[model samples]
Target: MSRLIYMGFKLLEPYEGKLSRTVLRGESGSNPADLPDKAIASPLMANYILYLYKTMRKFWGEPIVVTQELGDILGNAVIKDSILASSDTICLLDQSKFRGNYEQVAKLLALNEVEQRKIFTINGLDNKAGRGKFKEVYIKRGNIGEVYGVEVSLFQYLTFTTEKPEKTAVESYVARFGSYSAGLEAFVSDLRSSRLGLADFIMQVNAE
Candidate 1:
């Protein structure tokens, strides 16, 4: 059986009424006409997510599974829409999804041993050293599957720099690693190289 890889991002900061009304305007089952023209606007995070979706698709192909923590403030409708736009297969991580006393939802979601080994999670570290450390330890424990900590700031910087130069920092740093990717070219190169692990993993699974 071919191993299935799942990739997703976790927002470090919770979304608390930050999404602009503009993006929420055309949402299904929502009436935007009732509100004023300037009443709603999209948040910067939303734009970042859109860019991320495009990058993931362009580089890694469409994700077989997109997951978000249950009851997480960051798991809003706009984010869900962005995830769904890339792939229809969505897995909302919640307590109920787990069987028995298992706390690791990823393990429960895995259909088989190959699937368990193939799972990869990209956590939005947001420059938090402690969170990155925790993920490192968690991965070392080998109970929750494979986890990758992605610096949220680096992603934000790359997104803004790609769109408009001179706005974001020149040196983008990966959270907790003290590694920096200088300039757009270096950033793109590093990002692609880092994601190559996923590609390689998938390739190995197919070869098997």
Candidate 2:
């Protein structure tokens, strides 16, 4: 998906679709670290990418690059020289998995010790006593960055959750209420009134 943007963005430029955002998500599966190297080494790709951002910016477009393979991306020429330079805001999930090579990430992103600490502290704070199961994200803009906890409502989480049992619980509500949206509304309302934890409420639904 990410690599195709260099090839496809120009094709869409003439039509001028009303797309406000462009997302380039890297392949997160097991693969060689040099995969992006192969993608960016093409002179054709480099030339296409040079003009890609101009067209996107013309329509107030924001390009977001999502990659779990930071090792591959940081080492790749296109990301280091092109994408990173154009990107002003960077949102990072937990970097614990990359602690061994975090120095490269810091150097590439120009993060100092304090900002680096914020990246490491993603989901590390001991503040989840009452909050729902959530994750923390580190968003850095220019220089300073802060870690923010991300909590979602039962409806929101359940709507997108891929777990079969959990999805079945949500679907049961959708079945009873006639529509997914209204079912989500009713599900949240019932969960709120019951005062049960989300898992417990799901268990109750499963039991029924």
Tens-place lDDT digits, model 2, residues 1-208: 5656444444545423323223123212211112243444444554454455555545455545556676546656766687677887888988888888778788888899888877888888798888887889998888888899888876678888998888998899999999999988998899899999888988999999
User: Global lDDT for candidate 2?
Assistant: 0.69
lDDT minimum window of 10 residues, candidate 1 = 1-10
* True-vs-predicted CA distance for residue 104, candidate 2, Å: 1.0
**Model 1 Cα displacement at 63 (Å)?**
4.5
> Lowest summed lDDT over 10 consecutive residues: which window, candidate 2?
26-35
Q: How many backbone clashes does candidate 1 have?
A: 5
Point out where model 1 deviates above 4 Å.
Answer: 1-42, 59-68, 72-75, 92-94, 97-208
Best by lDDT: 2
lDDT of candidate 1 over 173-192, digit per residue (tens):
23323554334445455545
